[model samples]
Target chain A: MLEAAGTPQEIEGRSLWRDARIRLFRNKAAVGSMIILGIITLMAIFAPMLSPFEYDQIDWGYIQEGPNWENGHIFGTDGNGRDLFIRILYGARVSLAVGLLATSVSLVIGVTYGAVAGYFGGKIDTIMMRFVDVLYSLPFMFFVIMLMVVFGRNIFLIFIALGAVEWLTMARIVRGQTLSIRRREFIEAAHATGVSNFKIIFRHVIPNVLGPVIVYMTLTIPQVILTESFLSFLGLGVQEPLTSWGVLISEGAKVIEASTWMLIYPATFLALTLFCFNFIGDGLRDALDPKDR
Target chain B: MNAIGKKKAVPILSVRDLKVHFTLSGTGLFGKERKLKAVDGINFDLFPGETLGIVGESGCGKSTLGRAILQLIPPTDGQVIWLGRDIVGAPHSAMQPLRRDLQIIFQDPLASLNPRMTIGEIIAEPLVTHKADLGKEEIKARVKRMMARVGLLPQMINRYPHEFSGGQCQRIGIARAMILEPKLIICDEPVSALDVSIQAQIVNLLQELQREFDLSLIFISHDLSIVRHICHRILVLYLGNVMELADRDSIYAAPKHPYTKALISAVPIPDPEIERNKERIVLTGDLPSPTNPPSGCVFRTRCPFAKDVCATDIPTVDTINDHHQVACHFHERM
Candidate 1:
């Protein structure tokens, strides 16, 4: 009644989504992480124009040099005389691209699959969810490495591989959400109004469940990035000139005694990026939780 | 829309022996299913432009019957014949057009509306669904008009349901139901969730709208006074069985069955003197569980005048008067 009796202009209503956005922006940690993520993404995009040298540009003289700003090699040179700073920037592109693309793939597949399962309960839900449970029981990383071995280290395939494995959790999350949402009276009201199941699923059901899906998405992106790095460490990720943070870190690990900058720089950036994503995800979970409202 | 006003004698909805039984999840290993007969073999007819109130206690299955008649919940057995078409077991796809005509207003107003949609969108949803060719302007105009009719401000159409009070949200729910111009709108305890003061407002609004739209309503409620005020005919149910079905005056004045007598007696008289003098028939035992209802008669376990015959012999509904019916073997003596 407090809101109902308010003046018209004062009750200028905000939707659940807009309200969640306002709350998310209020959190300092989430906002700070977002800014760092933005900067890193921008650096990844403008790596070629900003860097003094190409990712693989070899200079035999300055090999294994410490980070010195004098020769325009801000992060010094790698063991193979390539500019480390530009390689790290290039690594950001590969890592972030893999993260986003893999997550996108999972989002599309998982949302559709879960919506179908949850909307049509009983036998269909049991079968669909049992399929997910079976997939969950499989050794995930082992399968990803197997796919890479079978497909010959294709970077695009890595996106598909990681996405394929990652969607099990997403499906489970979306399905659980959909199961609860499908029973809501609004859904019944929609059903009673002769709205087709398809419309009900995509328009009414999905929009409501998006809060959890979105929070889960933020969490999944960082996980996907870390998984890509692990694959690269195992020599199964982006090969050769196509460098990721994982590849850089593994290479750095080999000659850490000689030049610690390679290991230190990539690892620091990777850790910071993951930490920021986690913080933002936590903030989103808190903000979007219906219980909090 | 086709049969809105064509016939006067024929009932808009004829539900014959309708039953809705929910099977509980199986126990331990063998998983023997147990059936809870929520609405067990109930029959009723709803004519156009008349309000039929179903009054019962908490576990009387009144809500289940409403949903079963609307086909919102699938019935375990029997016919829900709407305009000669038996829609008891019709598939969801086939029920699409029929859904437009047979709409429902839920008990919880806010929960029954999509939290994400604006009030305007929620009201316009039925129109958009049933009349797909309606122009955006036309839909908006109709929504604004409906909102105005429901005593809600048309200017606040953009506000969400959360911003609205309980009564306002019920107004929104009513608007949604009335927008489609349905032949029948089942009010499933629409005012039960509102404040007592607000309940009268909603009830009066519904009465006004019913006249304005020539709408048939199956108003389900447990409040006897509210039912007596608005309902033309009241059906008294006890544990899924109709004890009495009569016009408001007849049911209130000379209730035949023991259960109806108890229910009507419980309604408090406004005058203190009459209220003090009134005889209240307070039943002793708790309502028998639906899963294990007493043999022959559902209300026998709680009926004060329960004899040996009441337990073994099922009482058939006997027509007591022109418009009064009672399903009690010992009604004449009572």
Candidate 2:
């Protein structure tokens, strides 16, 4: 079938992947979100270098100070006199880290579990899905609380807990996607070639199902970030010294009357980060979608 | 009928009493487990470098038989000897090396090629997976060569599958299958999804490639005319059982089995005058489900010529000539 498409030399004129990327870029909202996301990611990475005030540094003199542009406290100080701008910048590091890291962990576990269950089918699929259903029935807050109680409130534990819970939805999505993709001719063709089951699942099967997986992963990041923020708001996340956006929001909400700036700064940053991630995920959902092509 | 002259050379692939049964839980309230015999005791031999066509109506176990031979689906009981190796029950790990020799072309070309992957990547995947020793440049060169062989533009290697038409997609599918130089290719209705003109093109291409590669083909299709054009030998299956097996000419000119005869008569000839005059032998009743097939002969329920004896015992292949075999009680009278 490859021969009829014309020669490799002829294929050099234009590539499909490039064309897809071009079409994706033309989606102004997606592209714009991607750029903003890229900038935010860079800022998060260079938080230490960019922030003059250490995340833990406190100044009693500048307590509850509003955005003072000349003094270089661009977003002003929190109730603890910590630079809100610097804290939020550093807070991005933790929020993005937890979101990305947890999502990655979920993706690996989810895609593998889903592919195997969907590909093998029959009894294996039923059993795996039933397990997922059991997990799904458990309340999200209860599950997280149970994990925190069992594993303690370390950063790693938070990542593990969020990832473990998030994978259920991802597994369901991946399994559904795999069910449809496994029925495709290429998979059968791969089977006919005597390709190893492992290779078939990982190489051929996973790549085809990556579209939905990627879209789900994008959406999943926000969910994880929100969950982490909620946990931190309830005083169970990030501990005292190492603060996340959730920690900042939690602290800010306590001093809303005396220092509205504290509440507004962290809340705006949190909302913006969530909006950016959602926009990026939505863009990717459309871009990577085979139906759109 | 000179059976002695051809008896010495063993067929490249032989399937003996192949049965692929799926245990389906009853949909009713009871949820009783019932064995659905998808491929029921089918037997055939594929000669080296011969295109053995399996022609049957939909849900007649033709595709199931193809998959069973490849060990894509585990057979309940059977011996699929490919060059003396029983592949029916062979473990997937043990069957890995044998995969390079056996490949398949699927019916839906569009669905067969991965949409996300470029044509080049899709074709190179098998080579990369199996032949790991080959370097990047060598793989690219081989992919380009294989692409050329399938009549695809080599430059279009970077193009995704959706960019191509149905014929183009089928070509890509053919390229992927033939890239590794597999000896036995199971073409599961490869051209049935294509237009009439494209079907002829694909069939011709398959025939040319088969001769060039000296490959044996298990061509599965419901299109009798297309099967007649490509296959050297034909196997007629009905309700997961072999109804007839013969050389193409013998099957077309003189089909002994009533089922085979009915199937052939149903094919509409291109010529209007002959097509109008031709008597169509439409079989009575729907196809019996493989879950609970009729006793004795599976075709007895629908066979117009069936008698009491026909429903009592399963008909074995009765040799009509050196290469022609039919599974019908009245073959002698026919």
Candidate 3:
């Protein structure tokens, strides 16, 4: 009876990560998304070594050729008859690069901006939040389009545009978290310790706010990736010779009747990429969440 | 104002007429700037190796005074003299070196320790910031030693704050404060968030640490019982004004101020016989707003002993004894 009583108590006292992993692993969609995302990351990382055909290599005679797995064109040919599989691999690299870089840039700027606003509070917070609101009200897509029009199509430009547009949400989330965190005794304790403002902000304030920032960052990546893809599809991102899932899908859509394989393969990859990101994000949302734990 | 030759003992920390006012902007149609006197001309002294308890209800500016003493919030008007140096108007750069000497242990143990930092990192933070010369091994050993001193197991040093209980977390906070070996520790309700049993343990721990280190402490709380237990002297505050300042036994045995009397009478004694025999003094109305405080004496609105003179002039602090002081017109007559 003693052993039986102790067993349930021990189970209840399990580690937070154990509980988080249980919930995350149980999410089939999230798990499936993880697998797909992992595979895409691996493909992107090892694209050069793995792909048989050169990404930039072209075949004029077989431009827009359909898939023939036996002939080694497993995902068919693109507009330049470049192996679609290789192109997709390279495109994965670009998408992941833009997504990660843009998210990071926004995270840095937004976290700093929001943390300051929330920690100081009062008029400073009001003024900073108003600025965020003003930015939020503006037509984000139109601004991105104008930037693209002015700067012309460049790979880095896409990252910049996405980062600039995506940071507002991150800033708002960080600010809200910081506002609540600043009220906590630890922050006040830090202040009372005579710790400098810089140290308090970086050491005490930033660490407490990281959980929410990380969760939001995970969610933000998919949005940024989607936006980059959309821009690329519109010919304002990842220009010629440098392909992306969006560029490939856009090319495939234009001549779907002649080469259905082009549309099918790129579209499938794009869908799978999105599905993976959303799934991993959901899994992370559950896993990292202190409340759920 | 005479020097009062007895005051030359040189208080470790002296605060004179400390005032912290926040300007509240008007919200609606007719906006007016209203100044909220959080800490209104409060004066007190903390001697070396003595625990000074500042007790008041929430929003009475006890916490604000603690912060103002540390210069965490720039006081609107006041002089916070620590070791003869006025820290109130000191530059941030000038105060950096002094920070290591003056540390604080906050009320909520869980909220006070950085949740993201491991126990070792949290304790070692001050050392790293102030004494950067210490090697990694020395820092680790020091943190481990401090943790052991605080009665926590060495292996638990890698764990985050959330993993520990409230009492244990408070111990971590104490460890963090004491690791610096600060001259003055401002404990802002350190044990108020713990269980009754835990409160005793923390209070005992603080007393032990105080005696062991010969440290001066500013113990701020609303619990009169706990304050009486740990403090050498107690300063009763009402609406950002000092109502009474006396030795622990004197204040508890014969509180001169009406506010102090009301506060002591309200603390429920655990023993049924003693509790039944004790006269309960309940003040009639709610505490007046500090934004628009009573004209002369802040406590006049709540005082049962209030008379015409109580409203016209703020009573000065009259010496009842060498160390005891009471700010009430009737204290002399009584």
What TM-score do all the candidates reach, one by one?
0.96, 0.90, 0.89
**Candidate topping DockQ:** 2
Model 1 residue runs over 4 Å out of place are A1-12, B1-8
Candidate 2 chain A has its poorest 10 consecutive residues by lDDT at A6-15
Q: What is each predicted model's overall lDDT from 0 to 1? A: 0.88, 0.85, 0.84
User: Model 1 residue B240 lDDT?
Assistant: 85
What DockQ number belongs to candidate 1?
0.48
Global lDDT of model 2: 0.85
Flag regions of model 2 displaced more than 4 Å.
A1-10, A13-20, A42-57, A70-74, A122-153, A290-293, B1-8
Please give the lDDT score for candidate 1. 0.88
Better-scoring candidate (TM-score), 2 or 3 = 2
- Comparing 1 with 2 on DockQ, the higher-scoring candidate is 2
Candidate 3: which stretches are off by over 4 Å? A1-28, A47-66, A78-82, A120-152, A257-259, B1-8
Residue-level lDDT tens digits of model 1 in B205-234:
998988888888899999998998888888
lDDT of 3 by residue, B243-270 (tens): 8898888889888988899999999999
